[model samples]
Target: MSKITSIATAVPVYQQSQMQIYDAVRAVHAGTEEEARVLRFMYKSSGIETRYAAVPDFNLENGRNEILHIDGADINTSGLEDRLKIYDKAALDLSIDVIRKCLHEYMNPSDITHLITVSCTGMQAPGLDLSIVKELKLCPNIYRTSVNFMGCYAAIHGLKHAHYIAEKEPDAKVLVVCVELCTLHFQKDRSIDNITSTVIFGDGAAAVLVENSGSKRAGWELKKFYSEINFEGIDDMAWKISKDGFLMTLTNKVPEILEKKCKDIMDHALQYYGITSEAVDSWCVHPGGKKILEAVERGSSVTREQLQESYAVLKEYGNMSSPTVLFVLEKILRRAEQNGSVKNIVGMAFGPGLTLETFHLANA
Candidate 1:
């Protein structure tokens, strides 16, 4: 069995309130008073208080803007090349920071036998995987894998791979790193889809250390993983590379679709493990948005309190794509440590295929 021994998350230094981002987005996208009003309402009801970004220009308080100028001068003008350049530098820095924190007092960097890098917002050859190797000075022969363009649920794939590696090699130590620079793909457009995506996505990175269960460490033991895709909602959520940064097509229909399918997925996974909903101590649902959380609550046996850590992560960090779910799991792990009790955690995350990924974990 493989167990997650440690997790660490980090966001860029440039922090801004949801309203601050709304004002910048509206300045470029809203053409009329009514449009601005609608945008304001969306931001106010987004259930997000603050979000962090790799770019400082997101904070209008900084006086000058390089990406989203309040004057609408640079709206959609920054090409894909420019956005990726920022992504390359900021993503690597944030990944290194979180990985160092993840390994601190937990494990030695050189001992890691495998590394998995994940992202959806940015991509480049000689990608984050290689950069992490050089920056951390890990073993030159460390096995490496990259999960890219998988949208929000990509981190779970990384974890799944780590679990398999550990199970196959008892002495293996795997490090899974997910870093998303979602804010770099910010689009200045009037469409509801564009505005909604802009309001909810943020930038952050998270790292998890998974190792064989023989180690004498208390952590979450990997049990089982299940996945399903809602083909009908396939068109509702997508990520595409464009000449001008990456584009996101996220519609209002996402929550409704997930609401209808979430319970079936959860029930199926729990039954396979002979576990009941009530037996689970925590539910780490990805906080895609306010409506998504409400949808999960109504669809599954999970209560708002059981999802409190997810809500708290959303309220504090908004959605940082793949790394967001790990942030919630980290909170759950911390809470269990404080209480000095074992926990049964069920985790779920959604993404571009209208994909649903669920996994079970128990105290080791």
Candidate 2:
């Protein structure tokens, strides 16, 4: 059977407080009144009281002068590539570090045969997978795959790929790593959406080891997965190329759309698991943002308290893209062992392709 051996996670050292994030977003606004309005609404609605960015002293008023301007004169993207180097390297280092820790704890570094990485915030060549292989001294024969530009739900995509290999290859050992530097996608526009992005996104990475071994399962197992892409939303929540930089268009209707389509998605997922919603004793939800989470909670028909760990992760780390799910999964795993007899966990993520990736996870 395929079972998750262990999981580990990491966050960049560069950190910023919630108020700092608010202030930074404020600096991105185009006018004074608009700035106040944007910051107020973002702070009130985010459900996030704090966050960690990949860059130290990251602020819209990035200049050494630290002066605030209504026209966003202080905002600059000139050094973005330089900063990307730092964020990507730190994120990659943390990913390899966590995997090394997991390997040392449960198996030898030489045992891993595959590596899968997930990210939506940034991309680079000789990418994170090769970097991890070289840094950790894993077997050169190991295979690698990267799932990028998929937004918050990316970890699900990565897991789906790993599950495919584990189900097919005997004794295949796969390591899934997710790292996002959401702060790197920061936009200087004073728009409410931009401010909302600033308020909700954070920087972090996570690593998990899954292996198919000829022994009784001791951890969670992947049961089934489903993906849905609604073409109608292609332009709604897009991450794309532009002269300025990558632009994120998170439509205002995301929550509404999720609320509307959730019934069918939930029904389908439950059917895939051969169980009803009420039978699900535990939920490992992706806390993309406060409103997004609320939409999911409403759709799943799960109580607010049932998703407290997810909410807590949002409050502490904001949304760390793909790794955020693992943050919540860690809590659920602990909860399952505490409660006992808990057998099922449902995981989900949403991204471009206007896609929804859903899974039925069981205690292995």
- Highest-lDDT candidate: 1
Per-candidate TM-scores read 0.97, 0.91
Predicted candidate 1 versus true structure: per-residue lDDT over 1-364, tens digit per residue:
8999889999999999999987666677688899888889989999999999998777767776556644425454477888889899999999999999999997779999999999988888899999999998999999999999998999998999999998889889999999999988877766777788888999999999998888677668998888888898899999998887888998889999988989999998899767898889999899999999999989877899999999999999999999999999999989998995646889999999899888899987
lDDT of 2 at 76: 61
The local lDDT score (0 to 100) that residue 21 gets in candidate 2 is: 62
Clashing residue pairs in all predictions, respectively, total 0, 2
Question: Top model by TM-score, which number?
Answer: 1
lDDT of 2 by residue, 2-86 (tens): 6676877778765666776666555555367865875667676778776766665455444432112244364565344654566
Root mean square deviation (Cα) for candidate 2? 2.9
Model 2 stretches with alpha carbons more than 4 Å out: 59-73, 213-217
**Candidate 1 colliding pairs:** none
Worst 10 residues of 1 by lDDT: 68-77
